[model samples]
Target: MKTAIVILNWNGQKLLEQFLPSVVNFSQNEADVYVADNASTDSSITYIKEHFPTVKIVENTINGGYAKGYNDALQSIEADIYCLLNSDVEVTKNWLQPVLYVFKNDKKTAIIQPKLLDFKDKTKFEYAGAAGGFVDLYGYPYCRGRVFNNLEIDNNQFNDISEIFWASGACLFIRSKVYHQLGGFDEDYFAHQEEIDLCWRTQNIGYKVKYIGTSTVYHVGGATLQETNPHKTYLNFRNSLLNVVKNVPTRWFLFVVFSRLILDGIAGIKFLFELRPIHTWAIIKAHFSFYKNFFKFLGKRRKLHKKQNYNLHTSIVWQYFALGRNRFEELR
Candidate 1:
């Protein structure tokens, strides 16, 4: 399979300098490497031209964030598989081999994510995507090797390849045909959780999203937008709600939406108690944005022929906080 490892960059010269080498070194033999520049104002473009002349550059006219950046850049590139790698991820040697093997063998698998470990520590799973991603009853996403703030150590327990509800945007491997067929990502979500929406739609169309733990990448999570950034908080909450509205089955839609509002309110209050009022305000803003886009997303939902069953766990919130189950293995 012709695989293109495209790293989406937005003024991340330092990240490119740090992590791009590993990607080029490890992935060049298995795939073509391209840095999809999102109209970066810094020396990112020039640096790549000078240091990594072999690496191609796709310069987008405007900074369209993650969704449209890839959509625009990939249109010019020809490849069977597109690896939408984050600029901050450091890929391991032979990482592309196992991922390529799976895509070639399993025609049903549309998207895949490699095991994401923390670049800072290297021994633990990263927050963006750990083993694989799964969503709870209310469209809350969590991973097998991560639950809320808890990240699991790399003990090889989640080494087996398995189907997942979503693949992390941090380092996603997806089929080109499937990606375009789904109309790329919902650009409405400028960033954050858009991958979950795409992966959920992939499943709805009878394709699978998998996690191949045999291949791994280390991610410097929150490089672009720190975890504490209110804007990140806003995008995550808003996009997650949009994901449910756009993809959740009609039968469970109302209940899920209502429950999420209540849960999010609780979250906001908790944030207030923790002296993180900005996050609380961000959630409030997210709810308003979600409300504003509700009808539009409902229209999107109406256009789909199928909405896959996504309530994998009953409630990750209840399991994690109330029941004191912080680990993935403890949930069941």
Candidate 2:
């Protein structure tokens, strides 16, 4: 299968300078590498041209964040599979071979995520995607080696392929045909959790999302949007709610949304107690934003033919907080 590794950049010149070499060195032989520039004001384009002359560049007219930036950039690229990689990831050698093997072998596999380890620590799974992704009944996304903020040490415990609920946008691989068919991510998201929505919708239409642990990459999490930023919290909280509204089955919608609001309130309260009033306020802002767009997202939900209920989780919040099941293996 023809594969293209596309990195979306928006004024992330420093990251490109630091991490791009590993990708170029490791991925160029297996796939066509492209840097989809999101109207960066910095010399990201110039640097790429001067240093890596062979790497392709797709310049977007505007910076559309992750969802629209990729949607707009991918239009002209022709490939059977597109790896929507983040700017701060350092891919290992021979990473693409295992991913390609799975795609060629399984026609129903629509998306795949490689094992993501931390660039900071190296031994721990990265926060963005740690041994693939799965969502609990409450729309909370966690990974095999990560739950809540607790990360498991990489003990070679997850070095195998498996099915998952979603693939992290940090290094997601998906078929080119399926991506366009789902109308490309809901650009309204602009960023955060849109990948989960994409994976959810992919399954809705009868496609599998897989995690290949054999292929690994290191990620510098929160390079573009810092975890401490209130805006990041706003997008994460708001977009997750929108995901539940647009993707959860009608039978569970009312209960899920109601439970989400209550849990969000508790989370905001926890943030307040932890002396992070900004995050609490951000959650408040996120909820209002969700209310403002609730009807609009409901219309989006109506358009989808399937709204699959989650089959693998009870409540990640309760499991992690109450039962103290911070490890993925401990979650019931």
Candidate 3:
């Protein structure tokens, strides 16, 4: 099977210099590598041209954020599988083999996430995507090795394949046919939580999302956007709500949105107490954006039947904060 590993970049020259070698060295035998440059103003494209001749470059016309950037770049590429990799991830040797094995074996699986660990610590799971991701009934996303800000120490407990609700966009493997069939990502999202929306839609149309924990990758979380960035917080909050509006079961939609509003308000207050008023304001702005885009995303619902291999009802927020259950095993 033909697999294309496409990294999305936007003025990320330093990140490419640091992490792109591991990807090319480890993955060249199994798949072709491509750096889909998002109209970078820096010398990123030049550096790639000089250092990595084998790596193909797909230059986007504009600095479209993650969603539109990949959408625009991928139209020209031909492959059976597309790995939407981030520029800041350092992939391990034999990473692509395990992922390809899963894709080849499980015909029902449409998307897969390898085990993601922290580049900074090496012992703990990364914040962006740990073992694999899932969303609560309220549309708050958590992962097997991560919940909220609490990251688990990698004890080799998650070194087994399991089904997941969503795969992280940081290093996601998806079927090319499935990706294009869904018309790619909703460009309005721009960035953040768009993967969850895609995964949700993939399941809605009858496909499983899985996590191959054996294929490990170290991620430098928040390289492009810091965790403390208010804009990041805003996209996360707004896009999460948009996911609920666009994909959740109609019977549970309004209730979840109402509950999330209350929950988000509390979160904003928590940020105030923590002296991060900017994030609180970001959340407020996110809600306003959500209100603006609510009807538009609501129109995007595919009205397809979605049956899950896992439980649909979960409240990661309550389990983490109120009950003090930070561990994935504890939640299970």
Candidate 4:
């Protein structure tokens, strides 16, 4: 299969400078490399053109965040598989081989994520991806090696290949055909949890998402938005609720939605107690945005041909907070 590793960048010249070398050295032979610049105002595009003359560059007309950025750049690239890699990720040698093996052999698997370890520590799983992604009954996303703030040590527990509910966008490997057929991503999301929404839609259309744990990559988590940033908080809360609205099955819809409202309120309270008033206010703003877009998202839900039971855990929040189950192995 023809593979393309496309990195989405937006005024991340320093990140590109720091991390792009490893990618080029390790992946150039296995996959075509491209940097999809999201209308960067800095010297990012010029730098790529001058230094890495062989590396392809796709300049988007505007900064469309993650969803539209990829959508716009990908229209012109022809490849059987597309690895939507992040600019802040450092890939290892032979990383593409394992994932490509899965894609070539398994026709059913539409999306895949490699094991993501922390760039700073290297001994712990990264917060963005960890092993692979799974959602709770209430639409909260967690991973096999990470639950909330508790990240597990890299003990190779999740080294085996497995099916996952969603593949992390940080180092996602997906078939090109399935991506476009699902109408790409819901551009309304702009960013945050859009991968979950896309992966859910992929599953709804009878395709599988998997984790190729043998391939490992390190991520500089929070490269664009710090975890504590209020805007990040707003996008996460708002987009997750939007995902639930668009993808959750009808039988569990009303109950989950109502339960999430209460849980989100509790989360906001916790944020305030932690003296992060901005984040608490961000959650409030998220809820209001969700309210305004409820019917619009519901209309999106109505248009879908299928809605599978996407939740893997009964409740991650309950298991982590109320029951004190912090590890993925401890959940059940």
In candidate 2, stretches whose alpha carbon ends up further than 4 angstroms from where it belongs are: none
User: How many clashes does each candidate structure show, in the order listed?
Assistant: 0, 0, 0, 0
* TM-score, per-candidate, Cα-based: 0.99, 0.99, 0.97, 0.99
Instruction: List the candidate 1 regions with Cα displacement exceeding 4 Å.
Output: none
Expressed as tens digits, the lDDT of each residue in 1-332 for candidate 3 is: 99999999999999999999999999877899999999989999999999999999999999889999999999999999999999999999899899999899989999999999999999999999899998877888998899888899999999999989999999999999999999899899999999998998899888999999999999998988899899999999999998888877877778988999999999999999999999999999999999998878777765545633334437888888989998888884
Off by over 4 Å in 3: 302-313
TM-score of 3: 0.97
When superposed on Cα atoms, how far off is each prediction in RMSD? 0.8, 0.8, 1.4, 0.7
| Candidate 1 lDDT tens digits, 1-332 | 88898999999999999999998998767789999999999999999999999899999999998999999999998999999999999999889888889888999999999999999999999999999999998999999989999999999998999998999999999999999998998899999999999998899889999999999899999998999999999999999999989988889989999999999999999999999999999999999999999999999999986889887789999999999998898986
Number of the candidate with higher lDDT, 1 or 3: 1
Candidate 3 clashes between residue pairs 3 or more apart in a chain or in different chains: none
Better of 3 and 4 by TM-score: 4
Better of 1 and 3 by TM-score: 1
Report the alpha-carbon TM-score of model 1 versus the true structure. 0.99
